[model samples]
Target: QPQNVIEKIVQRYAVNLPTPSHKVAQGDFVSIQPEHVMTHDNTAAVMSKFQSIGAARFNNPQQAVFTLDHDVQNKSEKNLTKYRSIAAFAQSHGVDFYPAGRGIGHQILIEEGYAFPYVMTVASDSHSNMYGGIGALGTPIVRTDAAAIWATGRTWWQIPPVANVKLLNTLPEGVTGKDIIVALCGLFNNDEVLNTAIEFTGKEGIAALSVDERLTIANMTTEWGALAGVFPVDEVTIKWLRDRAVYLARTQNRKHERINDERIQDLVRNPLLSDSDANYAKHLTLDLATLTPHVSGPNSVKHATPLTTLEQQRIKINKAYLLSCVNSRASDLRAAANVLKGRKVADGVEFYIAAASSEVQKDVEKSGDWDTLLRAGARPLPAGCGPCIGLGVGLLQDGEVGISATNRNSKGRMGAPTAQAYLSSPAVVAASAVSGYICGPQSLHPTNPISKTFAAFHAHPQSPIITYTDNATQTPPAKSAPADVIPGFDGTLRGEILFCDADNLNTDGIYPGKYTYQDDMSPERMAQVAMENYDPGFTKVAKKVRVNDILISGFNFGTGSSREQAATALLYAGFRAVLAGSFSETFKRNAINNGLIVLEAPQLVSDLRKAFKGGEEVLTRRTGWDATVDLVGGSVGVGERRYKVPPVGRAAQELIVEGGLENWVKNRIAA
Candidate 1:
């Protein structure tokens, strides 16, 4: 059976399969033990779950990587305590740890060589797709999945439908990988590749892209609603590995044996590629030459427009940012510096810049790009995920218009929901800052033309490598006995339906980014803020609902971020089940792991929408149609109509009855 890159990678890592052929198809669920699993500041929460699963020690310490990137700017005692807990947990478990200010966890994995060609890496972050830049199959998993891997060194993942994207022509000058992705999001705003894996081809065009460019494009595939966006392992990839090996060896004073040419050549000789006869669910062709500088705006990544269109709109900007795991690499920084070389940011535009990692910061500093940005009135922030995840300074104030290089601009993600944010490349961000409006690099009118060539690696790195080894010989602790009765789940459930008639209702709107790092938050508090971003009065209406009430929404519910809290918050808010037209795969998994019932009933959702005629009355009166869900029968009865839905599998029913994957794993360990 011929396979694409994603399928091939899955086959390499899949374990405990039933067949000796080791063949898998799309939509097939298989157990996999990935080469690496990454978690950021959420490590604290994941650590709590790991311990709760009755696992005192890591099953495989080498497979776990912890980094403290998010919420690094919050020096509050609570944040510090949480960071300390993460550090202590990593040390005691013999896991590799990167302290705060190291960089975004995804980038750290790449810079340190953990995410290389042909490897399978999963992070508890939606942007883990960035690893595909170097030919790795990277995807996101919820935190519970992370905990399961820590306890058992394995978890199940479904192979998503794969899409093949072929690049036809080289990008024109001043166009970037960011522009290409923004264009894709804007043009294909109809969820063309939703929940699908993407494989990029076109030998000439792909070979023309730099590693940083590839990373930018692959990173934003999350915004495009793809599970993974992988590029081919060609000479560009092999050369990057060679350069990275040299840079790491020289800066860390590591022995060459750690990453030598012989090892690299082994990968080069046996490159990972899709078979010529491989099947793809969808095919898309993009001409890079036809693309221009583009920006995705205000509150949605799908609302993309060319720079010229935005310039004509004369959208004024009060805040500008060049940061995030997506576009803060060395090449992106240099691109911005090229535009800001002899220019100053326009008055009233507060520009901020942050490198993807501290090492990237050092690299740009050596190339003089760092000082150039500083002299151009740009404030330098710590080398962490500042302002990108809605933390730290430079957040957009209410009614302010901002332009950023971050991957997402979902409502209330960067600041107040009323604030407007536009996403673009680093050059566009710099130019917009200089013009005090949304524009491109051509607006700067620099003496020298912008340089297209960017150095792949700079050798001014300084970070201590830390590793912990667990040598304890203590006996494994006994697991608690399984519960006699599983709560909240039965053959039949009845509840009032709460309707939210909006498509692509993102995770940020469901749980809000402001409370993402609050590990100590109680379920009561989570319920209070549930859907606060989407509807400010949601909690008020939810408060009047009975326990086990059902929630119904439009298509693509829970579309953004890999935060499990999106589902857990609704669970805490008394929603026993969520029925939507469709679901984001990660959100569905997260809900299932947390024991929240999720169902797909497009016709039912449409019928409900027609019956309620927009849900305004439902919200005002605190009343809606009642629903009776029959799990065994796979039918939902609302009002006088009955709709058929996919039956819940026995495995899923067992997990829901057992109160989630954590409890199920605990019972299995005890058995």
Candidate 2:
């Protein structure tokens, strides 16, 4: 039977079915028993749910990996405690554990050979889709799903449709994989690829990219709101895996063996590929010849602009970073070194480099690529998610501008919400670092000297401080307006509709990661910063509204990051329920788990768009709009028109009645 990559993978791996159907197909709701499940930084949240359910032992310890990557250098006691808890849990359970500063979870998984072709893994991190680079069917799940997997070794999924994109020609010199992807983002943006597995095909494109380059593309699929971005297993993949195994054996003093010749052949013979006649919801063919270096400007991932015209935009940088999972591999460093080998970074600009993994750092050090970067005055930070999710190094001060190789450049991505961030290729970042502005490698002139006058900005008081915080007092969780006592979906809800038209309303934008690390924050405190970047006045608007007010948004709402606070913040702000055109898998689980109602009402969302204006108007409009959400009847009424939409399903409705996942699980334990 002909099938796309998604169907083939889902059919083979799906487990635990209803009596009517054991076989799964596209759009089927099936539970998956993943081969491995990874949780990092958010592992504590998973354990919280697991313990609440009275599960003493995880069902599959050997198949689990716990790591601490986000906020690795704990500034507060709370952050340090979370890391210690995860480390202790791993030791007790006899599961694999990687400590802080080792690497990002997804990158470490690939380096250690857990993300091999045909393997199915689920992680509690949005970038779990990064494993798709190795032809693995990896997807992100919420903390509750991770807990469920811990107890029952299974979690449910709705098999998504495949969006088959064929790359037509070889990439030009100096045009990196990041350039190609950002250009594609300009065309497709986030909405086009929402909940679809993006399968990249065409021999020319696949063959042109190295495994490292492919990883860069795969890592950013989350930004596209893709279920997973996959490349078919080929000779390039086999060679890369073999090379990594040998490298680790030689360098890390670990028990790493090359995949057996027979096993390699078996992998080759049973390669995961999309059938030529595979069904795709959308088919797009992009030629490499038409591509140029591009960047996604500050405040949004989909704002792709060609590098040639960046000078006209006057996008000068206060800092430039070559790090993050998207482009921090050994090959990525080599690309940066090529531009900055002998050139010095501008005086006012702070250029930082961080390797994806410690092993990748060793590889660069051995190759003298690390020395090259240092000679160019690029400060080398520890191997991890350094400053990507606002950890520490190269954190932007308020009003500062930055160009980074990280995936998303939404407002406050690096550190301060007032600062700006732009995403680009490493080569572009290197050249920009030297020139003190956004430019491609070819545009950098050798004779240009470092700027003598530093940019006017307040220097960070604690520049590069890596130590434990002393006297950091913890605060009791502050209570807020109690959840509007929602009776189990007997139906009618009338409230003002807070309309938002932006697709891919990410969690990072909803609740910044910087605040999450503080650990002493109350629900009210989080609510203050809720959607702070998206709308600075959101908290004030939310305060005036009564409990259970309907919050409506565009596609892939609450996408990006697995932090449960994204849902909790809105709940504390007194939102009764959330209605969206669609939602991310993890976001839905987190919302349902945290007692924040999320409903996928496509028809109602469409009707709301027609009623409301687009662009800044959606953010500006406040009142006079009313919505009647009829859960029992499954329709939404605005004025005279009534739009039919399905209610939140049985399981979610039960969660709503129980107040949250914790209450629901506690009730189950008591029963």
Candidate 3:
């Protein structure tokens, strides 16, 4: 069937994009100056690098922004210090700062009127991709890259490889993009397609999702290894962008063209279908009818079978949660409520709901959606990111397991380092809330599918908080007397390794401080928070180990949020090396980009765990620790065929000795 509705979406970008091919493909770098650039408090790391590189003044400070959306109202002075540091620097840099009143970076950006259709954008946060809804290419950059652009308004991207996610059949009325993504995750087992650009199309997509719903799905595409997931520009998208004052102001430039209109027309006239002969390392198809509502966990997301198969697993869950960008919309909230309306939650089951925006919360409350949730014993927390960030409400207890709509559930990410949280969609979360165990939407019927939303929560074209600023103090990059700092990490000489053989430990488990960290923190202030996952802080134990002291783990290590703080925690904690049987594709790149040595050996993972004697000598040569890991076999290899663990990319290797992105910039500037 022709995706008549989708043709409209496809036509928009395909036409507006004069050089779509430039934006497509790997190794071929693409360069396009952004209409706007945005950053967060954590982005301070990059700002420092920009300064080191002799960066001063933005092309237009009014267009660039900084905010303290994370770790606001620091609980401890240490955390408070982090915010103060960033705040001080932003003020001096003349970068706009959105006060605490604004929410996350993307939210505040739209609310403040920064995102506009047919424009280009880059952010320090991965979820920046959410901007694609308004018809802009909002993607993340490494701190160093952001700094370079911050100083020069010039940065480069390897034109990304493109994949067409063709949606075939009509979606069931109750279904959503959240459900589709969860199902898609089950199709791709590993991150073999990381850093590629994904474009969704096909007959079933038209009218199947609102632009906001599409934004919610695209927001999480980072987890899928996409550089950006885009849709063609359309009248609906242009309307959304036109609503913003900042957008209107930006377009006031005489040079600005109504590119959106022609692009929309172009897309309709000559669609950019996936090349008939375009080679794809992966091509997958799904039957919307055959997809059952599901939650992934107790194993790989690819292991997500069906809700019916859940009871067979009998994995009892302590809580069921739905919210986050994954499934936080009126439709999602309505779907969950539809299941629990007159029913009482099961014994031993705790249910919680979080709204992505207060706008969604208001809609839910106005319609008495809150009543349904409250009656069903589901707690509705503040609109700010909750367990989706692992900082506050809805965290899992140690040894406890819960089902959630958020992406990536690594060890202790939600709460207790020992606790396991499962990832699924709103329908699955809602159903499991009643069942109090791992199960699917079919287990409850009528509510077997989930609905997703994001951009729509704010129906109005304007948001009150428009910049990433508060008071005018410019915070500097954290600096303490080199001696004043306690040596959380002192490189050891083949020191004894402190090994835990758990596989797939998500970054959430390593840092588990997204909310806390974002609440207004300086890296130093938030430094101790990294160890909060373990009693008395894991750093204490980590510090006892020597340089080259290996921290060995099971398969798929570092599987959660893309925050560099996770690696920061491990690096500061005195460990010098990461030896895992297999690495999550993102974490592997992240570690190398940050200068951490990460080696893989899958079979040896179990043996290494058993071989660990606290402070046990871990010789690089003795353990066969030198190489790439065969993720499946636990074997290590080297050179071009190093399947077990390939050599780090050249650009990544350059980053290693330079300390981090900023330090690297400092050297580049000094030189």
Each model's lDDT comes to 0.82, 0.75, 0.57
List the candidates' TM-scores in order.
0.78, 0.75, 0.61
For candidate 3, what is the lDDT?
Answer: 0.57
Put down candidate 3 lDDT per residue, 3-110, tens digits, no spaces: 221122222322213233312222222233566678776666766666666765554565577765554424587766767777777687677776542446676565
lDDT of 2 by residue, 1-671 (tens): 46777777876776534333344444444557788899888888788879878878877787788878887766689888788888888999998999988888889888776777887888888888888888888888777878877776766565665677778878755567887777777667637777877888888878888888888888888887787898888888888777765666666676564343455668877777767766666666777755666788776887877676675565778999998888999998988887887789998999999999887898899999999999999998888786898887679999999999999887877889999899998888888999898877656654322211111101111111111111112321111111122355545678888877778899988898788778888978988899987888787788887656788888888877878899999888888688888898678778877767776677676766776754546462454678898764456887897765444433445566777766665565555
User: What residue pairs are clashing in model 2?
Assistant: 548-576
The TM-score between candidate 1 and the true structure equals 0.78
Candidate with better TM-score, 2 vs 3: 2
Error of 2 at 432 (Å): 1.2
Tens-digit per-residue lDDT, 333-411, candidate 1: 9989988988999999999999989899999999999999999999999888889889999898899999999999998
Per-model RMSD to reference: 10.5, 11.2, 13.5
The stretch of ten residues in a row with the least summed lDDT in candidate 3 is 463-472
Candidate closer to the true structure by TM-score (higher is better), 1 or 2 = 1
